[model samples]
Target: MRSGGLMGTAALALLAAPAWAQSASSGDGDSFLGGEWQPVDPAELEQMRGGFEMPSGLNVSFGIERAVYVNGDLVANTVLNIPDIAAITPEQAAQVADFNRGRVVQIGEGNVVMPAQMAGALVVQNTLDNQTITTLTRIDVAVDSVATLQAINFSNLISDALAGSVSP
Candidate 1:
């Protein structure tokens, strides 16, 4: 009878464990890596004119959690994943890292930092010129003037900053 009771207690404990575990987890599964890597919709697909085309075999297990636009063009996209970051290549990892380091998008008067995992494949459009700048780059991260720099980071990155705050 003791053994049966112990088994019953164990079963009850197992059932209760998941409830607590779910609270700590991003149960929404909205991540930029390994989550869902689906392709851009037909309406959104028209924007990728001068960048690496989304691979045909690109697997997307989850929907995009966020979409970023610049100059009315789709610039950055993010999702979630369940697997390890190692699933992507080192070069890809580097690109992702580069994309994320200082990715700050200047929308209107505000500076928004893009998430790291979705950094590599950002597609930003210049609000002024309406140009679709493919790829977030280190150069792009640089603020234009001292005022913009002041708006984002007041570091001395202005004179030595890259062309943009994004990396491919």
Candidate 2:
């Protein structure tokens, strides 16, 4: 009879486990990463462009995410999703980095640079008044090598800063 009671208690505890987990996982609605994402407006994109000039013959898009959360608390208010460069061959990507060597600039709390092969893409982030403005420019210039692209002043466009701010 004692063993039967113990078995019943164990089964009850097992049933309650999922409930506990569900409640814990639910968290506060505001604490979820998915809940923080909101659509970015076109004007916002223009503002983020700041003084940077876009190189001709390249495609650009902007996306914004609300602050990041960790353990149900706000960690980062904004995250700039890096542009996709999956279409570029690894060798070409390396050349892009080499072409922009020594052009990486750091201003305030942010950085601007053409990152290396694995890093991929050109990025510029500048923080003003506690907000971070990030821009990732993916240039699409068909050429045999980075040198050929450099001939057309491609490095100038890849070497500019983006503007925006994220509040805490």
Candidate 3:
């Protein structure tokens, strides 16, 4: 048979296959494939945060204040401190702002998962090599109700995993 005919036959065979044969199934009649969801412990969460490493020459620092399971979702509050925002070049500042502007930021070195954004807050959830880190930036506002600075929240999942991977 010609290559085109062979391809068509294969496609027909796949189309004819029953749905049950294509889907995941356990022998015990349960359709679900995985076990029940369990909350991650504090120690393990810390380990994940340790995995995240900021790029070198970024000239910024961050700290994870807290991590808690809210409605089965991990919520981490982090503070990213920019001591000398003026010291950083405009390009570097733009890079940081752009990092929070996307749903997923890929800097060619690592993946930054930003799921949502709101007034003065950026929600980051990153999972690399089976380690998951979710963070929520805690924003600080000035006396005039104007937002001034923002922090990057790191869960143990990111910090521990990225430990030694980032340099000052």
Candidate 4:
């Protein structure tokens, strides 16, 4: 389980990419290796983007048990094996609750105890039938800043520090 601080940081890094990218300077903006500094080619960024792809599917299996003996006891869990889904239709996904079809969403918490790393894929990818269209430009320079701010708030995250403290 993350202490919550780390989860916030991870979220910040994921959300603040464009903000940092815009402010970052390349090699002092003068010269590097006896040549003008050039930002990485967009083509390369596109190619590198491929590494992020995953075979589409849903593999779901887990076990949990909450038992209270007469003497007062509770909690049990287990490991389950779900065959590879890799790719499944909405009908299949519906079998698992909250597994929404169309458009990948953000974040997953491991077990009930571990919290999800607070990260949003700023890069929204659309995967189609055997083809994935990763939109490079769709990363709107503008987005509501809530998620970004919440990320960098390392000490106390929004959930904990959501409301400002007032002093008289």
Candidate 5:
């Protein structure tokens, strides 16, 4: 198909422009995305002196002097020490739960049922694998809908079956 038009030339020119060309190196120019620039008032400088502090200790502080959560004690004690499990998505968690619900038969044991603890460990392994995949795909958000939830659950099951974790 032959395509020649002024609109096409204009579109190409716009696409070729650098994303940051409109901004000044000092950031004084108007925002390319449309916004007004207002300088920080010099009078507010004195009030900013009490804004924040840099801790000399190794520990980081969230600056919540008073706990407002329902589990105030737990929240205060665990906030800093809490592990970042947010990296795992709700879909991955649901997949792990569903995989755990299925019956597991140990191979070479003549279809003997696996012990509960051993089954739990296998479920955990599958869950960890799911978390790794979801992390790779950057989908570490809550599963609010059924379709998305099912997709992640099925993905984990398929992956486990393909990897020989489950029998055909």
Candidate 6:
């Protein structure tokens, strides 16, 4: 009633062979996976710099320039500009719009504080007792976004935040 071990082992070995073979150091033309270890050339990677082909799925391009898009969830992002919430800065808006035009660079991080945090800090709390130990930590990125219409005065923002001039 329970004899599927060989199939499981074979499947696992097949999946793991690529990773194990890649790292095996063999000078005698031998591999731990019973195959020759082949080195991947850097030029090959460069040659396939653009989009990759999937056996099945959508065909996309490695487009990194401004373009008019349709029916796509496009978000404008940058490292040099921040949106002015008080009022939209024409220049910053244009930069974000232009940056989105490229349509290749994807924004991985979002949810920025009003004034970006200069120092990446984590808040941690730890408590211990004879019976139990409790630890809590929160990680957050405190950095400004790239697309700022104008320059930011960090000192002023910090001073104002500290003085309760502005509520975070």
Q: Give the number of the best model, judged by lDDT.
A: 2
**TM-score-superior candidate, 3 or 4:** 4
**Off by more than 4 A, model 2:** 1-40, 49-55, 59-68, 77-168
Q: lDDT per prediction?
A: 0.39, 0.41, 0.38, 0.35, 0.32, 0.36
Cα miss at 101, model 3 (Å)?
1.6
Query: Which candidate wins on TM-score?
Result: 4
Q: How badly does each model clash, as a count of residue pairs?
A: 23, 5, 26, 5, 0, 11
lDDT of 3: 0.38
Residue-level lDDT of model 4, residues 1-168, one tens digit each, is 375656556556657776666556444565434455466775444322211112222111322111222213222111111223455446434433322111232223332221243222122222323432322221211223434344445435444555544422
- Candidate 2 lDDT by residue in tens digits, 1-168: 576455445445545656764764576654334666654685655434212113543344443333333334443343333234455456545544454442233445645454554242233345545544443333221222333333333343333222122322
Q: Candidate 1: lDDT of 24?
A: 39
Candidate scoring better on TM-score of 4 and 6: 4
Per-prediction CA RMSD (Å): 22.9, 24.0, 23.9, 19.8, 22.8, 24.4
Against the true structure, what is each candidate's TM-score?
Answer: 0.22, 0.18, 0.19, 0.25, 0.17, 0.16
Per-residue lDDT of 18 in model 4: 66
Those runs of model 3 whose alpha carbons end farther than 4 Å from true positions after fitting are 1-70, 75-79, 89-95, 102-137, 140-168
- Residue pairs with backbone overlap in model 2: 67-76, 67-77, 131-165, 131-166, 132-166
Residue-wise C-alpha lDDT for candidate 6, range 1-168, written one tens digit per residue:
133344345345545655675667545666665665465684553332234232333222232222221225333222223322245467646755554433232222433332233222222222322322222222211112211201222333455568785564
The superposed Cα distance between candidate 3 and the true structure at residue 138, in angstroms, equals 1.6
Candidate 6: residue 132 lDDT (0-100):
28
Task: Candidate 5: list runs displaced more than 4 Å.
Answer: 1-142, 165-168
lDDT of 5 by residue, 1-168 (tens): 123344345334444443444443236455544456455574453322212121321111121111212212212111111112335456545544644444332222234444565543321113122122111111111112334334544565577568785565
lDDT of 3 by residue, 59-122 (tens): 2233223333334466433333333444655654654565444333222345554345342344
